[model samples]
Target: MAGSTPNDQPTTTPEIPDHVLRVHRRLVEAGHRSLLAGGAVRDHLLGLPPKDFDLATSAIPEVVDALFEKTVLVGAQFGVVRIIEPEGEVEVATFRADIGIADGRRPETVRFTDEKEDALRRDFTINGMFWDIDAEQVVDHVGGRKDLQLKIIRAIGEPRERFQEDRLRMMRAIRFSTILQFPIEPETWDAVVAEAKFIDDVSGERIRDELERIIMSPHRLAGYHLLSDSGLMQCILPEIEQMRDVMQPPQFHPEGDVFVHTGLVLSHLSEPSFTLAMGALLHDVGKPGTFEDAEDRIRFHGHDELGATISEQICDRLRLSRQQTERIVYLVRRHLVFMNLPQMRIARRYRVFEEDGFEELLELCRVDCLGSHADMSLYETCLGMWNEWKERAPSRDPLIQGRDLIQMGMTPGPEIGSMLEALEDARRESEVVDRDAAIAWVQARLDGRQ
Candidate 1:
């Protein structure tokens, strides 16, 4: 009777997954109360397809294991289990109340409890409601429905206490506000500012994950502003914070300071990849330190090179993969090279496009232009060249190899590599189009050295 769907129908019926419905039915038939909970319920109510289904119930861990055919004790000690089915995996957590949070991340202990106690222990109100599959209603014990209606993100209870329980909640609050396009309740936002520094207590990996989600979200610029406004940026990414107030030449960057320029560039990204997003965010990171009030105009001499070094350090701190670090660093280093495109010879342009992640580099340049002066002249030229190049036959295979140099009576050493590089350059420029021509060119250079 406790799990039975109410006879009356609700205005909006959640498109519950068939597998989830089966599991819910099974648990109910077994006399254990079960309800769909957490983000699934929130998303459903908002008319978005739920990401995943999580079940909360009165049944304890052991009883849940007995009722389900395939059960994984993912967090058994904490009253959580994973029920795997052909359709999908549903995380089933027992109703429990958190006791104490000693580490600022997890509760030191938890006690099994009823629905109200469980709902009260959650971080945000909108994430605290449950959908009663049996009752055809949303069971809101913490005013979650009211908050949802107002499009506000409010902590479940005392804001400070909730944040103190998990310092990462500060970032989560910002993320939810950005993603949902909802404003944080004033008190909750104030708590975020007050507890911003404590966010350092969270692990770098967790913080990085949260930041990545914010970067990938459609409202990334909003998230960026919230992070800055909340003071979390200073604690987690002071490099970015330092960009604040750093002036760029107005002629080149009509977008105010480096920080404003960076935000505008980020906003213009179309289908951002993580590396490209990070590169755009930190492209001019060195401007603050390199800022110079020159006689002619503002100058950030060598900012690109300095920014690359700084970006690598930041990547290391965030524990990004070696590959990701290298690509991001490449972007930062080469972002300025596009200005030299017109001066470069055809071979030089080919070499530039041959480098790894050249497409992303071009994309960063386009956004950088759009964000600043709205000039696309250079971007259009480069794109035209790239398109024309793509239509041509692929660059022919190198006409010579290191082994060829050795066979040509050259010593197997650094000079061999040097010769090969010179030959390739010639080949790229079409000066040497055949194997015999490549050999003849190399011989001529050697004879000249003599």
Candidate 2:
């Protein structure tokens, strides 16, 4: 999930791959003016390699289908078709103008139109340019080239109308600003702020995906600040807004407030995976719910566990994949284990090293500390111990297995799992020295329970 740095400066546009150029030529040769459209044109001008290329043409979907050997009419209503080749595929869509509906993204009506009309209907000026295939120049009907040159994110036409046609455009605006590291135009920013609440009209999956892009970017912390400033954070993640101004005991957290501390944690991360980023953001999420001022210090009695539950609910709301949610929750729940780890028994420490997500957990621990007290003693210790056992112990054959337990007269059930955990813990401590000893120890425990 860590992000890579993009190109330093805009360069000459990338040469069109032969297969892609073929589609453009075919459309043009047939007298249907085709030009490279949307992000590809924008990225080319920016010197970033566009992931995929799309074409906008005067031809309709049916004409495109008839022209190409391998074609799929992905959206006949919108006049879009995919041209497949041995190398890859290109999406060729008819030039069209659209009207945004109030409730959802589907345009009220789509009319096949010309290049100028299509460019005017787009979301952002930077993305509204088209590459003139024959003329070797950019066709900027909506001042896209100027906006891109100035490094500003500006809506194509009326800002409100552009966002209202599709609410997801609001999130996309934030995403582009954050990723491109460009400031939003004043009017566009206001429109996003005024219509931030409509983000909910977009589906959870769509929101999740766009949010993922923002969270995954290196400038994500800035993205969050923008989200908060623009009021989008409240509609999308009110839980984060809850952390605003929550006080921490100054002795431990010299950082100003909960939100500031979380931002610091986010800043400390470099190329963080999605799980790490989420864990950092939600690490102290439960502080508000569990905060208590006792005689001695401010306490969050069970904030770690509580934060885990709350994070799960948040993840479910965002429609995160089950695996991503589980790992994130694990990091939040066990983040405090490091403070107690120094006092823990050797076996317990080793067990921590052996946990499934130990590496990510350790990272969470390091950042959590860096964000707060700036302590590294515990992290250094854990890293040392883990390094010592790095070659052995963690992967050492379990002194026993389920089948071995069954052979010793233990049935296949939940208790077998329990026994294995206990046996492994004892084995790590050398309390059970070998396979025979492990079997004997478990047999005795089973006998005692019986």
Candidate 3:
């Protein structure tokens, strides 16, 4: 619902994009009441640059389409239309009161109504405010202005009823709280905890999208903690919950438990890629399952190998793409390689360098060390070696092709692949520098085999 605040004024006027203003003006001129709504108004009040502008209007979807030169009926059935202009697109939703939410996601029926009814149906107070484009004033039908001032995320109406209407709002509340560095109102937070389990009822794609936003946020650690506290993490990622009291070898990890260590690592990540962040969170996921208490010391003998398998399963459950899953799994599997850096042979080192996503693997190792013992000796050594490898241009074109081997009267079989792999390993280590040398080396191996 869009209305003008009678007494309040914007501290700093936000530069409304041209397209949004045009749409609002056109709608108003056509005898429809239109105003900037939702997050755009919230952002403007906060003096932060808004990402996108959305308009709430008395005009129905058909009128919006008729008024705009180009319009997309993005959600026409729900009284939403996108006005496309040369500058950008603005979403204009007709003011409506939702009747029922049988699906727990969208309204089964919406009644076109005035601003107050529309404002009452929104999720949170901070998101329900509007800015009257014509009057140059702020609207606060749901006490949104006060909530924004207090830095609190409060549900617009009965918290339980609002959450029951849309389970994803539970995740969204956490996201907004963390991203804005605000606290959820006591009642709202309580309701979130009460309804956290219902989050699993939402689609995996929606869950994944929300999870990605939380993980990618600058305050991701805070978001993770909120998820855990609110019980949402248990429903979405129960494996992470299992890490709570999983003991680590104290000598190596003075940071208490696996969960604490992961949280610490997450804190150290500065401008992390999504894969790197997920890797940090799940790197030690195998420790809880493989914990061994021996007289010698605590040991997670093959946690890296097992963690990779677990990561793949998690990725598959989350419906991540094959490429994303592989990269994340690769990071989990190879996070421990830094420990072997000094002992690795030239061929092994070359092979490590040639693997995809080596940079991110190193970053994960660095943060992992930081989170644990804070001893960066291995990380530093690996980084230095990686730099040297980069300076030397370590990667080289294959000295010989499989077709060349087939052309040389050798039978095409598993032996061909084996021979090629061995030759490539030698070439990576600079044992053979040219095609002729590679041929001779293969011939010598074949001769020895004979």
TM-score of each: 0.92, 0.91, 0.93
* Top of the candidates by lDDT: 1
Instruction: Give the Å shift of residue 422 in candidate 2.
Output: 2.8
* Root-mean-square deviation (CA) per prediction: 3.6, 4.0, 2.9
Please report how far candidate 2 places residue 61 from its true position, in Å: 1.2
Superposed Cα deviation of residue 142, candidate 2 (Å):
1.6
Q: 32-86, model 3: which lDDT tens digit per residue?
A: 9998899988887777788878999999999889998888999888899988888
- The candidates, ranked best first by TM-score, are 3, 1, 2
Which model, 2 or 3, shows the larger TM-score? 3
Point to the candidate with the largest TM-score. 3
> For residues 291-402, what per-residue lDDT tens digits would candidate 2 score against the true structure?
8999998889999999999999999998999999999999899988888877888788888887778898888778777888897888898777777778654556777789
The clash numbers for all candidates, in the given order, read: 3, 1, 1
Error of 3 at 359 (Å): 1.0
Q: Which has the higher TM-score value, candidate number 1 or candidate number 3? A: 3
- lDDT preference between candidates 2 and 3, better one: 3
| Candidate 3 wrongly placed segments (more than 4 Å) | 1-7, 443-450
